[model samples]
Target: MSQHPLARLKRYDIESITRYYRFRPWLVFARAVLIVWKFAGFLLGLRADRGHTNPIRRRQRAVQLRHILTDLGPTYIKVGQALSTRPDLVHKDFLEELTRLQDQLPPFPNDIAFAIIEQELERSVSEVYQTISADPVAAASLGQVYKATLHTGEEVAVKVQRPNLLPTLTLDLHLMRWAASWLGPHLPLNLGHDLLLIVDEFGTKLFEEIDYLNEGRNAERFAAYFKGDVSVKVPSIYWRHSSRHVLTLEWINGIKLTDVERVQAAGLDISELVRIGVSSGLRQLLEFGFFHADPHPGNLFATLDGKMAYIDFGMMDQLEQHDKEILIDAVVYAVNKDYDHLTQAFVELGFLAAGTDIQPIVPAIESVLGNVMGESVADFNIKTVTDKFSELMFEYPFRVPGRFALIIRSVVTQEGVALSLDPNFRILEVAYPYVARRLLSDESPELRRRLLEVLFKDGRFQWQRLENLIQIAQIDAGFDLMPTAQLGLQYLLSEEGQFLRRKLLLALTEDDRLHTDEVRRIWNLVKGEIKPDRLWGAALGALATVWPSATALVTAFTPSEQL
Candidate 1:
């Protein structure tokens, strides 16, 4: 490996780059000048055409942008990867070009990478490993991966970081931050937050990504989230052989989710894998709050037994419990098409700043997202919504929260992977069911409040919405009817149920008329859906404690009042 012809460059480290750092700023600045010139040229051409941007011209300029970023190396490549996920920030054409930066970088020489491994691990590669691959199995922006076996006969994949990254990353981040501060106001960009904030967010995540120790810990934490789950797989970290620059993990033998042919040929159900991906992702965000941020195809795999393996934990993000509840509220509001609450959710989520005059934005949001739920499952996906949302962001004062950048990226990339496997796969088809199940079964006080909000409005029970929720929730294989029934009964009998009970009582005689017909419809819906004799007996027994007259309960549903 050391004799490899590509290993001609001198070994580099933080100390070795001291002299290079002096001229590095100039080199980087010179490249930045070239980039600005190219972009200015593209803008001038668009202006010359009276702002009617030609698609061909846009695509050509996008290609140039991608090439420029790649030429600028790791920092810019990573910046491009972040931008690729931001449909609101970048034009779709430019995003399409920048998406390639997720992978497809030229690999560093194997010999140099091996040298990094030896230095980081404090041992010769041969001493620690029984056998190793001559070249990397995968190359990424920050590191390359090698397949190797330990002396103990354990198979592992070793990831090694690029040399002299700290100095380069530190310098580049400082430069980018300075540039953002200097040029942010003059740029014709629609952003809700300061441009410098975004640079800092990207810089923070990038710094985290290069730390192999952090990535390993993230992998373990992610694995712990899915512990004992059979449908998902996270590779085990080999801590003994790992360091800040090198990571060894149990090798995963699986088919890439994007390899449609291979995945199908492996007899794995692609739709099922997609469902696993969606459901697991939902739990990560809404339940655990920690999520795999970069879910591009290279990071996700389908095992032979139909498990979805998530690799590459270099980029992960978390949500606060408050944010999780707000997100759920937002989803519920969107499902109900209650744009008022949805708009408030945006404000609460930092998409709209405080005192942003949401009154006007509410109608605009309704116009953009109103028809989302009405779309057929086959027609609904995140991409369509985001594309429209990207437009809305331009017209409205909506800003992408820096924290939500990864969340958006994870979801969009997962959906894209699913689409590659099945064109008709809708994220909401699986996502809605999971949300419905959570609302129906979860006993959390926050979710309980949200569920009640979904089920009741204007002091009346929304029976149709309840039925719809039940129907949608039934789609999830993990959604159990008994637990949901029990949860409903428990909540109804609890102290918090007082408000709901009063609403139900008032709904029965709001117009000085009996609503037994509506009540009977609910009874029939429940009876038709839950056929278990034990469930009925239990439900009646529970209801008897509150309503003493079983006969009156039955009599309330006469022919005139019956469903």
Candidate 2:
């Protein structure tokens, strides 16, 4: 067999072993640092830190934790915050504090920053920029932003990746994974798999973040997704002057979504902004399937003119068609409070493997949905719904798909920002009509058939579609509920149903012989789930009308005990 690319090159001494060996010393240092943090964490978890029977110390512990994360710098902030998200591993209070590491440390020296920019873009500073800022406007763990004007006089933001970041990130991850390997055997949880999965996720995001070219493409794709919407603006990229380490794009000037007071001062309608944010999020999730994965307050801006502009496209995710359809069906099931179908959707959507029996999980799924959808539409809280499910997540054989993780993260983050804008805001409330309309309009045969189930009970019409009618009244160009009814009618009149009625009649009248077992099999379902006077139900009754004579003839043809 041919060797892999890395090995093939290594065979010719094309890659040096020396640079690989550099991991050893950094690994040792990172390990010691991690050990200290773990010790501190262990102490924090003790009853004394929580102040057994002492509310005062318990409150104080949260404060101490906030300070510890602020002092631990980039690596800990990233890994710690990631770990905090796992309820299986970290305490809820610690998770809250770990997420606070949003602002970055001081900027690196200007000359090194400028040199890296030049190296990546392959141009002199004068060629691309009319004037660049002397200091970075903002900094983050992976990179920092500088306000600059392009040569064409278009104001732009230049994002420069941190100096020597890749190697350092590599070293930090090696140490982290190495520690996970050492600690995995001792933990009750699947620490190795979970830790490595998170680390791999973080590393992927880090690499994507550093590739300014990829970030530039992401911006273009996002722009394309919302190109026609006046309220949605994606910063234009100047590709001729951009590269893997340096990204240049049109700059946005707006009040941050989190700055509630300033936004109110500006006389902007905060509630309207929340609607736009929620609509945009649903479009990404249910419609386009490709989404800007990070919609945190800092990355979203409400322009003075009221457009909801998105920034930071480096962390983007794409949902495949199958997952999208399954998710849409799941949402429909939830809206209708159909837990059985919802559990089936959950199973088909890789929440469980294909063909997995859903009977064991149906009640558990119902319990989770009950707490979320139990409230009236106006009072629904998407965040609370997610939190309720998280409590029950551990009881199942569930694996969080990467796209799903990003979707949940993006949704929760944007909702947080939206809530910051308006305390009364509710995404589920805003999203209901949009999702309902989409569900009503779905033209797929399978989905249309599901709609039949939604619109009718057994053999009778369920006028509750009028309730869906009211739910969707807010959607522009309100949905045609008539189509759903038409579909239900079409299914009953379909060839398959007609065939069943004819097949049974012929077996009874022509041959004076009916398959007794087949007749019972068909009627069982008809009696159980099909309404007797309903379309399929009445047709089934027609077949049963001949069953008495058919049964007598069958008995006459048979002997003894059968009679």
Candidate 3:
């Protein structure tokens, strides 16, 4: 086997040795290679003595681990956050330690930053920016931000990608997948599935972050969604200068939202700001179905005009319409203490398996909620609930979708940030009213009309199938011999099959072509089972046989202007 490329990059330490032993016991023989140096250090008294194992050393070790993960690159820092959420998957101490993993990477050289800018925008910095600062205002895992001024004299924040970040991230993700695959079968948990999914999600999010065009669109979408709201603000994207790796936006000169004293000094009501923040987050998650996943305090600012400005659109998540409805149902079910409904929602949402026992989980969930739900919104502890959920998930080992996990984390983090501003701030209190309004106000007249049309169409098809079945019965009565009777039964089966095929084809033809897999599968099934000898089946079967190929050909060549 070829040696793992990442193995050469990683340090072989006592901890690595231990992890290897636990995860891959066949590597026990390799322990000799690592132990020799440790023994030599111990004999020389150069390593940690018993007295050195103090709380301060432990703290320093935690700091060192944070630095190591950050140095390992963006993917590792993301993995740190992921592991922090699953206390069951990792040791408690390690989870606590990794939580300190910050995205405070040092900025790449200014020359490289400028090169990235020039390459992405296809112009010199002077052409676009009236004054481009050499120094970065802030630095994070993926990119760094520089304060700049546009040629039009508008102050803007220019986000520049760190040189060679993609290559490093790609390498890390590949290694992670490889390692997960190697250890998956022997591990107690589904490390392979979880790790691959997490890494894939990270890659998708990372790529989106790198694509400044997508970020620009996200910002515009957020702005357009909240256009009438005076209290909320999203930076306007300068499309002329923006590209995949570079983003230019209107910069707000404001205080960090977390700076309560400064915000209060600026004549903003902190309590109202907290309320608005929580409410805006809920709207993003539940209503618009698109949200800023990383709404940490640093990404939010309170402007002098008392408007909440959201910055850094790098990590945005979108919930599908079905997913949004499922989450809402789950939230409502939880509040109502409807365990069965909650479990069913979980299954429907793919959070829990269909066969999983709900009986054991109810008491655990109820105990976790405890008096937290009954308490005033301001008094509720967001961290307590978050921790309880994390712990429960660990014990239960439920497979939550990555998107859902990130959404939950963002909601919990936003709630925590709000609570930090006002101890009396209740997330549920603010969220409840918004959810209630959404439930009551969402009329969806078009959706209701469409649903009725579908039911009516299905009823017509069923009646046609019944009439065909009766006709087949009459034909069967005419043939009294056993072989003829069997053929008649087959004919009836084929007729019924044709009716099913027609129904399916009508349904598929009317629906959007986006569901290609489903359409192809149904079409194939219909084509394979129905035959031409059966008159009722022949026409329907012929359509199914031709539609998939026709659809494929259209999908293939529709993009090209052809003769």
Candidate 4:
């Protein structure tokens, strides 16, 4: 058998090796060694300054680590933040602590920043901009943002990469690869996916982030996805003045999403913001499969007109279609508290490897969810549930796929922002309706078959699916009527549609007929309107009358506040 080209053995290119040597490989090595050497002293000081057992001391230590990582420049801060998401690599305390590991620094001088822009664009700063801020609006490990006005008079936020950032970060990645190679043998669990795999994935994502052109395309792609959406916003990029080192985008001035008091003071509904945030995030994850991987509060804002504008397109991720299906299944199973099905989803999704003992995994998941979600699944908190579950799953042969790690982190962060404003907000309750709508609209033959198998158990349609559908429809207000009605009409007005509709109605209604409440509601609507000579649309009128669920379904399709 032939091995795959990627899997085949290959020789190292001495030219590339020598190129690294030429580009100050010694400097990278020295910097890495110096950082590691300093780490020993850091550990000693870390212990001497605080007690590990005390919560206050631990928090103080966490803060110390946060500051240390931030000061370590872009690579360390980025690597620390990346590893913080993986439960297998770090503990819950460190994970929570690392969340405070902000990527910020004193802005490098204005001259150097301007110099880089001029060099990249091949034009003087005066030619590129009418006026550029001498001081940066925000500075971070990798880049700084400056408010600039283009010669064409468009207000823009110009992001400038730090001087020599790539060379430094590239060297740090080499050190990381070396460290991962060293750590692989010492790990107790035979993790199918090792540190090398994680580092490689991170390297690809980081490389993408460093390329401003890629960031520009990501912004355009995301904006195109939500082009007409009034609730969501992605700033347009001014690519004429942008490049690998600098990204210029339309300036978005809005209140930070985390500043709840000010947002409320500005007369925007905090709860509505939460709903929009969760819904939009889910659509990216479940529908588009491309998401802004870092949707932390700082990267999000509410415009003066209440639009949720997203910035920072550097760190983005993609969810494959196969993964999306498994995720959808996992969510639905979790919502139903069907741990067995959830385990099945994990196995199919390759989170838990095949042939592994799933018993321990199944009940463990069930216990965690039961404790976190409580008896009422609809009222479950997604952030708490996922956090607790992640902490538990690390014990098993469970791997948080790279795609899901970012998605989970982004969502958990958003949940914190949402909870800060509304204590009663339930993300699952807001998201489940979208799940149902997706299920209903899915045209895939496989999904259709699955739906039939699950809902049409024992030969006829099970009324429970109808009940659940109604329940989900009532909760999701984004229900669109015409297209859904068109699909239903195409199906119902067809031979198969008519057959399935009658069969479902027969299974749901009493003897395939309307009940007293249904009859009364129908009579109340059409008592005086129905005439002896006019019987137009009588079948739909009767269908709506006979089934309360159908009435709710039609109401879902109609234009209304909560439809």
Best-performing candidate as measured by lDDT: 1
Q: How does candidate 3 score on lDDT?
A: 0.64
Backbone clash pairs for candidate 1 read none
Model 3, 1-563: lDDT tens digits are: 23343233222122333344456544433433443443454344424534675666656555655665665567778877766655446544455677556787888899888887887787888887999776999998888999999867899999987766654555445455556567666778623246556656666676677677888988998999899878898999898988777888999899997788888788888877886788788778777898988787889988888778898887888888877777776665555555666777877786667788878877777787655666433345666776666566667846656667667668867876887788777776666555444442333433223222322343442233223222222222121222322333343345434654565556545545444565455345335335434433333334334455654554465334331
lDDT of 1 by residue, 79-113 (tens): 88888777667877777787766555678988888
Rank candidates by lDDT, best first.
Answer: 1, 4, 2, 3
Q: Is 1 or 2 the stronger prediction by lDDT?
A: 1
Stronger candidate by TM-score (1 vs 4): 1
Residue pairs in clash, model 4: 491-497
Pairs that clash in candidate 3: 212-244, 377-426, 378-424
lDDT of 4 by residue, 514-534 (tens): 545544553553345444323
Compared with the true structure, all predictions reach lDDT values of: 0.80, 0.67, 0.64, 0.74
Candidate RMSDs in Å, in order, are: 6.5, 12.6, 17.9, 7.8
Off by over 4 Å in 3: 1-64, 91-97, 190-194, 375-379, 445-563
Model 1 global lDDT (CA atoms, 0 to 1): 0.80
- 1-563, model 2: which lDDT tens digit per residue? 22222221211120232345354576558656865775576465765554375655655676666556556556655665454445434444554555564647788888888887777677878787999999999988778889999877899999887776655555555565666668766766623246555656776665665577888898898889898878788899988878777888899989888888888898988877888898889889877898987677789998999889899887788898778777766766787778898888866765566777778888887887687666666666767766665555566654454447667777778888888778887666777777666655565665555555665555444445535533463353444444433343444455545743453355444435545655464355234334323443333333334344654555456555422
lDDT of 4: 0.74
Count of steric clashes across candidates, in order: 0, 3, 3, 1
CA lDDT of 205 in candidate 2?
68
